[model samples]
Target: MQVSTILLRMPNWLGDCVMTSCAIQKLRVTYPDARFILVGSKACEIYKADSLTCIIDESKTYPKTQRWHFKKQLVGLGVIAKIKAYILYSLKFWQRNRIYATYLLAKSIGKADLSFSFNNSFFGALFLCFTGSKIRVGFAKNARSALLTHALKLQDSHSMHQVQKYEFLIQDFIEPGLFAHILPLKLPQSTQSLLIDDKQHKHIGINPGAAFGSAKCWQKEYFIAVIEAFLDQGHYVYLFGTDSNLSWQITQGLRHMSITQQKNFINLTNKTNLTQLVDSIAALHLFITNDSGPMHIAAASSTPMISIFGPTDTSETCPWNEKIAKHYFCSHRESISKQSLVVESNIAILCKHLSCAPCKKRTCPLVHHNCMKEITPQEVLLIADSMLVS
Candidate 1:
């Protein structure tokens, strides 16, 4: 099969995009010479180092798809909100993504040999259809199965992690049993990881913001308590904030600290690009974060990390674990980790097991986000202490 080009619409979020690396890695193996045209938001910056990848910056590949954007519109409106949510679920209203997909044929891309999407939206399926590729692939939800040449059913992957789901899609649909491996996410070869040379205190990062929705975020008080502990123990605290408001909130919580102690709290929010962010995170002694983008990046860098979980299920989206990763292995990634000592990853899940919990909703539909709130700072700190000492 002379596969010259692959048009891949990447997943919207940083973490979702990162999760697809294993599949892309396998695809690269199946068609080493195929040109990978990856399209996404600024989140696509992570793929910049791949020499064969053609990066396309298109944020509206699906618009208003953020959970917080819909949470406010559908929370209490009853039947009207449910109707709206249903419509928004497939993101069918946004024709911009479809239009962009259609225009790709006119550009240097011409016609792709293979077109696929990590996004499972109805509009996402339609986008692939507009590309006019010989082979289009996606999940067979939103009644768009008729449009795809290869459509994988949703139920078959209900229990699969995002990484495995993607890898399976490639192996089953594109190339059957060609390769049986799920390699850990790894950034492209670069100038090596970067960090300041401060050996006096071990560096630990705290990311309090969750871009998905408030339901996915732990309590601010808990984050403050953990940060205070890190400072008191003579460790440098790296505070990561995506927005200025979240950065301010973290600062307000730490106002009680002395100026000298506060110096240890370094804020790297709204600064640095994707590459810098990855390098900075790779240097950390340990990373503590909500189930957010940076969490995935930390996992890729092989940094020991603690990922806190709430409404989201740990089984699907937990950070990379050396123990769990080897179980889901592939050829190229099998030969590594020869070191005698390794600092692996851990999870601190604090869901009350409420029926409504793990709803995977952007915000809590019940108005009481106890799942995330119930996660105590003490519990997270205990894990942090153990990771630091080891």
Candidate 2:
């Protein structure tokens, strides 16, 4: 198969984008001699460019909006004209590949030799189809499956982690004999500096918040309890976040806190890029967090971790690495706290089944979030103690 340009549409969200790294690696292994160019969001632009061979930044390649007013006037035209106008706009924008978007399309198909979109969205698949690549591949569930030359089905089982899901998507294209547990990351020197720089008294890394929403966040007190346990064990806590506002909230009660060895390292969030985040996570001996991006990174780094779960099914997206020594769940039933998957984990898990279980609601439909409230700090301590002893 002779191919010049290979275009891949990256997942839009942070966690999905990170997970897609697995697919990237598989593609690399499959097409060792081919040029791989990925189309990704602005937020992931730096990561894709840094990690992959060639990246067609979506924000750069796709038109966000037309020039000043002339573009708007075209949109007002009839449906056929409007469609023609947008196609022309896409072709033109894609051609100049210019920062601005309106260029030209010489033939029915655009520039890419082969293009694959990771997402199954109609629009995402449609846009790729519009480009007229020789081969288009994505999940079979893709809304625009008819427009594609190749589509694969993703099974509905919880047997594999989410990262593996992305890897499986590209299995047909590559030699399916090879497989990897997690995607690899190449950290830059600047990111490495953040990992090694340690003047603070304690070096405990804390992921106090989870982006998956309240359903995944364990009780805040559980975090505090774990912090105290780590302090007793002689480690300081550093909180990680991709948002500045959340970082400050994590650092709020640092000085007044009691856990003897605990110190606030909440300032590290959002300031550094993805590479630094991975490096900093690598430096930690252990990471205790809710089901979130940092948790996945920590797990990929093979850091001993205790991840809490609530609303989501761990079988579907839990940390697959053996380094995950323990997992804590509020209750696996919908009868418990619906609003919050308030749960905790540290080292080893003692009891998993709760009377009122995985309610799966943001707030308890019954108005009482008993599943999480019932779990005490002492229980987590017991598990931690057992973990250290073992």
Number of the top candidate by TM-score? 1
Worst 10 residues of 1 by lDDT: 334-343
Model 2: per-residue Cα lDDT at residue 3: 65
lDDT per residue as tens, model 1, 253-304: 8999998889988888877678778888888998888888888888778777
Name model 1 segments beyond 4 Å from true.
57-108, 173-178, 189-194, 325-352
Write candidate 2's Cα lDDT for 5-101 as tens digits.
6777777665566666667767666777777665555435535435454343443444433353446777559989888877876666544433223
lDDT of prediction 2: 0.57
Best by lDDT: 1
The true-versus-predicted C-alpha distance at residue 284 of model 1, in Å, is: 0.7
TM-score for each model: 0.80, 0.69
Clashes of each: 0, 17
What is the overall TM-score of model 2 with all chains considered together?
0.69
